[model samples]
Target: MGLSKRRAHLRKAWFKKGCVSPKKGQTVAFPTVADNEFVRFEKKSFDRRVHTSNNVLTFKDTDGTDTTVSALRPRPNASNVVDEYSGCGDESLYPDLCTNKLMVQAKVQALFYSSFKEHRQDKPNCEGDLNFDAAYSIKWGLGWRELLKCTKCSCMCDYHNLYEEVENKKRSG
Candidate 1:
């Protein structure tokens, strides 16, 4: 039978057998539900909803490669709002955003001083790795990778460049 028809039959059978509302002091046998199938269905539905949303931002470079930048990552704090730094004169902006401005300046120093490789093979991913590199650079001295500004988009996508470089190499090979 079709899935919908089977589900309807199961629903009717469940209702008929009092699975929906058990009698007083009586045990009810419920119809079996596949957890994996249910989870897969839910994930598919959620993915559809996310992809259809207006909040999703996509960027296409001059090379015609589509890059999607969707979803704002929340701060480590419990609150939905990102953490702000009062020191930046404009208290409204997140500290991390303010830090990027400093990073832009520091990149000039790195260009002359740092011996970090021009192309990094191990491109960083995950919040921990990204944050860890950013965090440690202040105390541990300047690293090789400088936050390179994209001439096309004018966005400070340091990691994005690394990933793109790796992808280009793979395609050429």
Candidate 2:
């Protein structure tokens, strides 16, 4: 877990730059082409090390007109990866995910049931029927979300953002 977290921090730092290596109380080391030491137009050149003080990657080059450098959307495979996105973590940890409009609401709803139980479960929900309800909270702007509806008490559990919407939909629909 710490490995993943460290990797996440490193990735974020890598993109923003200004990172000094941990050894030098900085970040990382990137090899750079010494443009100032060029012998001729296409003759000789020198190599140097540049601090990752800017967003551009010193070691990378693009063949096109794009001078700026950025991380590709699809990341490479990693032995350890961290979920660093603000709203893109486990539901149990970050329940207030609705604020980030970019986060996707639809996913494997199985993990959320325990979260539902953790926050909204009452003492009398032993006979609750836990299942995924596709259209339960759509009109509330939550998009497709799961519901933990207790058949015994008719009490429902959902995302914090969907509480009012789910209730209103139940009443009107």
lDDT of each: 0.37, 0.43
Give the TM-scores of the predictions, in the order they appear. 0.17, 0.23
lDDT (0-100) at residue 51 of candidate 1? 40
Using lDDT as the measure, the top candidate is 2
Candidate 2 residue runs with Cα over 4 Å from true position: 1-106, 109-111, 119-121, 139-143, 160-173
Model 2: lDDT to the true structure: 0.43
lDDT (10s digit) by residue, model 1, range 1-173: 45798788887667564345556679879998544221212333333333433885333333546534233322233333343332556665335444542234444544423222332223322121112133223322222243433223333334321111223455564
Number of clashing residue pairs in every model?
A: 1, 5
Instruction: Work out how many backbone clashes candidate 1 has.
Output: 1
What is the lDDT for 21 in model 2? 58
Tens digits of per-residue lDDT for model 2, 98-148 = 344322343433336464555353654365554434335443454434454
Q: What is the lDDT, from 0 to 100, of the residue 43 in candidate 2?
A: 14
Spell out the clash pairs found in candidate 1.
116-144
User: Which runs in model 1 stand beyond 4 Å of their true positions?
Assistant: 1-28, 32-49, 53-77, 80-82, 86-97, 100-173
